[model samples]
Target: MEHRVVYLDCYDGITAPLLLGALFDIGLDLNALKKAMAALSLPAHTITSQKQDAPVSGRSARLALDAPEKAVPWRLADTPALLPPGTLKELVRQPVLSMVKHIAQTTSKLQKLPIEDVSLPDITTLLWLIALTLGLDMLNVDENYVSPLPMATGSRQGPHGWEPLLLPEALEMLIRVEAVWYSTPDNKQVSLEGAAFLSELASFEPVNFSVTQVGYGCVPGKSASDGGQSLRLCLGNLSPSSRRAPQPAPSPVQTTLEQAESETDWVTVLETNIDNMSGELLGGLLDHLLELGALDVSYTPMQMKKNRPATLIRVIAPPELGEQLAMSLLRETTTLGVRFQHMQRLKARREPRTIQTSFGPMLVKVKYLGEQLISASPEYEECARVARERNIPLADVYEVARSEVQTLIIGSRKKT
Candidate 1:
């Protein structure tokens, strides 16, 4: 099916008003948005926007919730009354509450108060949450992929003192969502409203789509800081892409394995070169790194600096665990520095299954490309142990396990 897709380039960070403004610029129905907002029946609010073509060109939104009503502290019970009953509610009701609960839960911990007793500071916050959410779903996009976030490292003088560009609230939410981010020298600050709202709506994955329209969401800045920081949104029709499973080997009693399914997400690669590390010491780290949440680790022999033979240690891990793994590497390996970068990884979906073989039950990894099963490989460690216990060759133990799974697959296919 052809799907509408939006690519959000959060190079500078995002804001709820900026988000909705971009969606509005990209053809979100203004009347429909007004109608959806009206269903809430809260105090009156006005949504306005204007085109800006000065230091920047885009649409900026102004959301004015009524004074007294908008200041009401948010409660969990207020969720049901936040949205009217309809498709929009069905799509976004839980996400809106989930976003609120995340804040409330964090607020509870920070304040040393009970969770039920915590409430968002004001209803304006909740209104913006629902509005930003509705803005996205109301577009009816099938998928939205967010670009890697930029950690604005530069700071400036604040009224209090020197302050970091990204605030504590925004940083906390970024961690909660496990955002894929990279350090930037740029001084753009991300807001909690932006990060929290986008977390529940989009993914950081690869997409192949031809953009139909591009909209910039920014308000013309009264000063330099606010002027150029804008969220770039590209709307497009998604090109269907599928990971096809390789056809399995044919047999007389053919076991049509299920196709392989695949998933894509960001992973961090930690690499460093070492010239004076012992092979024995480096080899011992394979298991050590695995225990430290490394997805995979390996070493490659390479020539570094004229004639020095070095081993390049590479570690692939979840971005969230990258720092921990890097720390472990520095402490354990004879390396001075570790370089890390986040990259999107596409891998076949696989699950563990136990099959009764001649040597009893053995574990195997059942891999799928989608609905089709491509291959079922016996677990190496388990097969090796079973071979030793049964006093049989390892290859023979593997064959027995493979045959067992094949028989099961064939029988199941026949029944179906």
Candidate 2:
């Protein structure tokens, strides 16, 4: 099944209520959302949605929380404790849980605090609600894709020179999601937080995606100057051939045609020399960079000055992420300088295909180059996982996948 792509346009800025409001506007059943909230034992809240013309022509949702007349600020550590037994396990699936954990760990590291120390009740609650609404399936999101612009950092003035306070929780949410941050015209302090939140969520600028629907949410007493005081949530579908699209049946003729028209693009290569960092740290760094969207990362042994043994770290990434990734390298590694170059790479048309094996279903990467089958390999990670679970040799699983792919390819060729 194709994963759904949802975009949050915080043109006005993001708040907990605004996030919920947007989800509600986007066809999330109000009863379902309320049930999820109740499962979490959250405070009573009412949702109101209506069509509005200020920001754009769309429906908007608003959430009103019923709080005590005098409520004390809650500690971030205690937020998760409020959830009912098995609530998180039931509501948040593995994929969404992975993302949530990433956010918590990253925030904890960035803030120089324990994971439990990072807390914002409203943000945490809203995230759970959003997760429950969206379910646990992984979105077809690129690992290395970063927003072209950064989120707004400073406060902006209003008609009366009133500066809006940016919400730390909002900013943290954007960073955790790895969304781009940017400043929009007609900026106001009131919208800064939401703007930052939305900017990051809605940051897929160059990709060709179509917004199938739009949802809006509003926060009372937090209106932007343009009267579009609501958060716009856009649910988009990636263009055909998106990685997130379902794998089509293997077709050698179609694969040949695509390979014939395959295009080459310039890819950036970044290298840095390091001697001080430990091998364990380098390994971890490689994993981090790959997760951040590096096309490839490697380390080569070389001799530095004074006959000292060192490792030369190399990273290949798309041109769009060259600078950002380069900056990350400097920040994450002990290297002070980096050398980079761009070179053309010819990529074969490829897609993933699943084959039934004695052990289980295994995925194989089928590659084609201009009407000719170039390569086919079992996805190592999948094979490894199946091997461990089945208590069998990894080579047996690999051979099964390879034999099946070979049979398919040969049969397709004979048919053509």
Candidate 3:
């Protein structure tokens, strides 16, 4: 089955108002947001989000502040209080708290100040944080992917006059997550509140996923020339792939228990996101990666930038094959770059055992934790063939095979 994913293109950078606008633009319910945010007990306020195309493309999200920055600015530690206790839905509570902690810690580490000194975002941003968190849950969002930071250039009019392009807190978040950022004379700075929350929720996505729709987040008060002024959200589904037939040539790296366990220290992960390839093309690419000696190759559906459906291809292999596999990705896919990471890996000792079953003979992979039994799984191909020949339910073959394997293993252990 395929699942939904949203990709936020933060080329222009984000602020609380900007995030609100984007959410509103991307089909976030304006009225629902107002009702949800009203719980803050903030001074009288009304939010207006219109799907306007000018000033910025897509739709515009406007937080009309009926009150000034309010006396006694709320600090990061006080964020929990800003939204009344028990006001948040249980599903979003932990994630929202996690966002708050990420923001505070990011601010503290970068500014050389205590977390308590880090101030809470203004009313608009605060409200948007809650809305976005709740929205992610409501959308049943399985994952979020964020682009690299775009360096802020020059200065912007701030409450205290001209200030650095991107807010300090936002910059801290960019640095902490090690987000790859680019700066040009034409870059736009991100907002303090926008940066922290967006950074926290993002997980890496590989290339070549599928996108189904798009929503735009238009920043108010900024034009295209301002740089990084708008946000584009690409929505898509990631399909779970069917299992592959066994490969015989080089066999497989994990053919034996020892090789699988010993690979712990040498495994490297290679990934890339691709949007321009078709399903037929991907099959060829998968075979190519495996021929390069990949222990496993998998594809996940993902939304790529610029309203494109893409695939995130992941390859697991020993370190020795890293260079070759990476070369294969670049040579075969539309991706401009590839990402590599070393991973700690372990596998239970498993071996094929021939077991008697009502259908006839069956092959099962018996696994162990040291000397103790773990599980015995009937091979898919074997079970599938049994189902086909006898015209029985596939489930029946699986259940009967599992039961016999268990009985046989237990009897042998007792005799020992």
Candidate of highest lDDT: 1
lDDT per prediction? 0.74, 0.59, 0.70
Candidate 3: where are CA atoms >4 Å away? 40-43, 69-71, 110-112, 155-163, 220-222, 226-228, 242-365, 368-416
What is the overall TM-score of model 1 with all chains considered together? 0.56
For all candidates, the clash counts are 13, 8, 20
Candidate 2 displacement at residue 271 in angstroms: 23
Per-residue lDDT tens digits of candidate 2, residues 96-163?
A: 33334444555576678888766543543444434334421123322212223334455656454753
lDDT of 3 at 86: 70
What shift in Å separates residue 175 of candidate 1 from its native position after superposition?
Answer: 1.6
Candidate 1 at 23: error in angstroms?
A: 0.6
Range of the 10 consecutive residues with the lowest summed lDDT in candidate 1: 252-261
Question: Number of the top candidate by TM-score?
Answer: 3
Tell me the tens digit of each residue's lDDT in model 1 across 1-416. Answer: 44578899987678787777888888787788788887775667878878866435888777887676446676754565565445354446656766776666566666788887876656777777878778888887756778888788868886769978876667776676678888888776577677677556577666667788998887677544666567789998863343122347755433322223357667789888999878888988878999988999988999997799999999999877886887787668766456565565766678998877777778888876665565687889998998888798999888878788788767655775
- What's the TM-score of every candidate structure? 0.56, 0.46, 0.57
Candidate 1 Cα deviation (angstroms), residue 86? 5.3
- How far residue 195's Cα lies from its native spot in candidate 1, in Å, is 1.4
